[model samples]
Target chain A: MYVSMRKLIQLATVAFATLVAGASLAADKGLTFGMLMVGPYNDHGWSQSHYEGGQYVEKKMPGSKMIYIDKVNPADRPGLTIPMVVDDLVEKGATVIVGNSDDMKDGMREAAQMHPDIKFIHISGDDVLTGKAPANLSNLMGRMVYGKMMSGYVAALSSKTGKIGYLGPLINEETRRLAVASYLGARYAWTEVLKKPLADLKFQVSWIGFWFNIPGVTADPTQVARNFFDTGYDVVLSGIDTVEATTVAEQMRKEGADVYSVPQDYIGSCETAPASCLGVPYYNWGPDYVKLFSAMQTGNWKPTWTWSGPDWTDINNPDSSAIGFVKGSALNAENAASLDQFIQGLGDGSISLFSGPLNLQDGSVYLKAGETASDKQIWYLEQLLEGMDGASK
Target chain B: MRMQGLKRHLFEIGLILGMVVLFTTLLLSLVGASPLEAFSHLFAGSLGSWAKFSRVLNVWIPLTLCSIGLLYAFRTGLWNIGVEGQVVMGAIGATAVLRLGLEASHPLFYLLAALLMGMAFAALWALFAGWLKVRGGVHEIFAGLGLNFVAMGFVLWVIFGPWKRDGIASMSGTQPFPLELWFPSLPGWRVSPFALGLTLAIILLTAWVLYRSRIGLNLDAVGRNPRAVRLFGLSPSRYMLLAIMVSGALAGLAGGLQVTGIYHRLIPSISSGYGYLGLLVVMLANFRLAPVPFIALFFAALNVGSIQLPMMMQLDSSLAGVIQGACVLSALLVFGLRTLRKRGPSDE
Candidate 1:
């Protein structure tokens, strides 16, 4: 009895010391960052890039710690709802929670309204812009529209059969805008850059109606991509949140089909299929978040609707930019040089694809001749521009 | 003697639960988490607040209804694994009625009509599976599973093709039903008093039907010996079909409540695997009615509390599933051992 009592006293002392130390450590921690991901951390696409951004914040900032909840999507983890996730994260001492993905918009907005003290950064949503979000919530997204245009330009130049197929995921303003931008780039590169007739170049976009591949609800992207190859779309561009384009292209290439693919949302995604990847138009979220984190630490953070583009000087810089297009192994040297020139022209304001005589899918005038499209028009693009052979409505 | 038997049963249940707790703690320790803190967080997150407990009740309503519905089918010796499909079909039915723009009418009429439509649609779906099992000589498991996939495809087509909002399809689901069609909530909580009352009614009804009705004896007879049921001049298939339909209707009503009470729209994952979870609940209840609601609430607590694992402890929420699976497994083990002992030493 004496030995057991002594042991219990010793254990209590150790527990008390550890509790105090933990409290002190938590108090001293500079900024606690939490991230919510819709997919696994290593998905090689959207979620992976967000995870890397979290890692970058941890590395670049001092006296800070980070935690992330991955695979938080409802389709797989049905029992976990967004409000529950948010409450738990807030209880665990997260000052700022980054709700990644447009699918998480409702949950993010609801949580932000419920918890006004904690800050929320929602990526790729118009809730902030439309004045529907709480003051504590801000929307941040990259200008991937331009990068997707660049993808179209490269895919057009490299395609042997001028037919390009876009594996689309859902029909929304964001997706419609991106698909239209790619077609714009494809038409310009085909008629002006490649000196090909407009009739010879074809771009077809198919909608799967979800961000990732859901087997039953959405069409299988891999099968759709393989069909694109089988039916003569030599260059397929991925608009979904998976590296299936590169993987599918690599498999088809092995089977002796001349096919190439453009991946979305990551610079290093070419490693998935080196021989088939043309390039990737990836979101570099680290820099903007780091700035926000710094400003927040100093108590000067203002909720801004950030629709940032790439750094003109160094597109590959991990800071101060939202969008970057990374060239891959399959891009030929000559094609790469031309694509670089095109990007430089875009940077210098010499080439303007949005400059107009543009028409809607119904042959209605969208932009008057010599009138450039405004940010609102581009951001809320309503339809697939005229001449794309696919359903926009 | 009765008291002694009850005591032995209670003691065995306690032993199984103790084994489950020990196993789960050992697993958490393997993942480098303090098991005590993990368990405390779970209890606090699930039952520590009125809001949290209400959410647990919200989950419990659907799970309990589905489990009780499944019990009817189980007692009739029918494997109605397509309860998930029935739930989806229910949502579709409710959504169709709400689309009629009849919110200006009496709210109770709208609610009753929507729920009835939901049950009717789900009954039709379940009857199709029953037909396949009886006529085609196909296994009910395969038929139910296949029909579930078909129901998913049907929902997808409706959301994308016919009922798409404003000429575009999205993952956000069909446009929300007008506010008037939404189920009235309890004064200060997210859950509806109507929904809670509905659940209680269903539970009491199911218990009465199972314990004090002639149909209960027929179902039991069908499960044990269909030939014996036939000797009584009652068609076994008719009773089996009745069991499947009643199960589907309950699941469908739960789905309807989800649309009118919770989400207010038909999302793709509206059912969210509650059908499967309900199966687990019934299994853990040892195929009895009285213990189902309690078992379901326990499941809900585990599921709702597990969100904290990922948030507070950086642990995977799948660990909740592991704990639940372990509990059921230990119960099964204890039950098997009891049966062996009852059979005497020579039987083994």
Candidate 2:
């Protein structure tokens, strides 16, 4: 008994010494955040925004250190499972982990359960603190739908055939609501504001399951653009990051389709397609990046959705307003005037995306047939009306 | 002398090391990175912490299992090259069970389904080669190669057609299997216990079976000369088919563990180059059981390290491919020299 007492006393001393050492280290250490990117930091698409966000945090916080790992194709299996990556990051001293993909939800959930001290912020997923997850795990998505609506107006105004098609990725809540916003915005401009008969307008929307070109599929935006133009829709809108849709517009120009295009990140699409592109609906992803991390630093970040978009201004706007590039390839006179009018109206808020009596493609009442939908209800949109061609359960 | 063989191996390892250094240096230079900086980045990225070591094991476990399995067939001189197909078919079988609601509440049933179905599926695929080799006097390699294309066709047909996710792009996968069915991720380890355990069991069992049994001696004779074994009253075809069966079963086990333990669903990406890598490993180890894991881990380190190198070095992940090709080439050179010396002028 006496020998055992001596061992217990020794164990207690080691525990106490380690505890005090940990306490001292906690105050001295810099806060480390990990960013898990689906593509290279320079991808210029989804990963670029997250990289910029990490840089924003680096600039904003004095003592916060950012570490990143990228090109984490979910297929690099075994130890590279998304959750495994999260666990490794947390184990390596990151207090907060940022996973920039929706497919990472299960991984984030599993990692959060394993390490309660580590906070995981999964982008564009529906899972948050309450159901099937804990307080440490949450999700955030930007309201790019508002930006998509603005792009829709650009297409609606540019269309000469009175028909326009929107090419989007996946029929999930994100793409579905964005597609709805695009059509609703266009119909608002074409029918309600222009005082045109509802039956005179034609709009179509289709979705491909992924964000970029699917090599073997007919869903390539460039191909879909030809589909729309051949079917008499002169204007095309793209909801994906790849420049395929704009490339299709460039192709259409070769044959005199006179079809216009709204490509997002308009300035950056040149890697593949050229500047016949109209303005893009780009994300001013800077604000939320600054806001969320600052809140995290102050221990004030909460599980609430923040929508930051629709800031239509010059490309140089600190908000980086989603700008439509003026038609670069010889904008013949009348088209220029039409494009400017659309831009000027959007800039002043004289044009609204959801001033609706949003009707189905079959002319059936969706939002009370003749009355406009409220700003609040538009944010919670669920389904696509008739002009859209996709389904989700 | 064996000492001469040792010196030759050492020289060959040096040549492989030189090739890898030159390979990465060229890649980094082309990407506008200083090769010195890229080397430092490679070191820092791969050996940066213990977590990275865990990532190495995650890759090592599966690769080791596959290499050891391939070693079995190579020992008996049967070119059981359909390992890739057998692995995929086996994974598809296990996933089909989960799709039918055979949940992991019955662990024994799940494990048995995984192993038995893997063996059965792989055996069925192997039967093609067996039939061709036995009945038509055909080469198993060509038959096995054709079967691989069929497996790939099967995977694509499901992804784009019937098994497609509703309204989702035809991404190469099924829904993640129910979590309860996943093999336990080892505590503080990225690899599943099932992978590590099964690989170890197969390595040990194979070493014992091939080295200690009388059938092993007959297999050696059959591999050396079927006519000699035929006069010895042994059926060489039976031993040859047995060797292929063992090879396919182990490869199928690897596939089932991959989908269930690692991927959580069948993915078009799962086979990767593991079966091919396994072939290189068997050749390098000279089909010895003891050194297979070490060789597999060396390749695994290249894979795990490549992910980190791209960011720090500005080099593409394909640089790992260059290093792997270099290693295999060097090992082949050493084997070629050893074999030539055995038939040198003195023997002639």
Query: Root-mean-square deviation of each candidate, in angstroms?
Result: 7.4, 6.2
lDDT of 2 at B97: 69
Top candidate when judged by TM-score against the true structure? 1
List DockQ, one per candidate, in order: 0.39, 0.23
Cα distance off (Å), candidate 1, residue A10: 44
TM-score against native, each model:
0.87, 0.82
Q: What are the TM values for chain B, all candidates?
A: 0.91, 0.89
Tens-digit lDDT track for model 2 on A278-331?
555555444566566666666886665444454555633644442234343433
Q: Name the top lDDT candidate.
A: 1
Model 1 stretches astray by more than 4 angstroms: A1-30, A60-65, A254-256, A291-303, B1-45, B48-50, B101-109, B130-142, B178-181, B184-190, B214-238, B313-348
Given candidate 2, what's the lDDT at residue A73? 55
Candidate 1, chain B, TM-score (2 decimals): 0.91
Classified by CAPRI criteria, candidate 2 counts as: acceptable
Residue A95 lDDT (model 2) = 83
- Candidate 1 lDDT at B82 equals 93
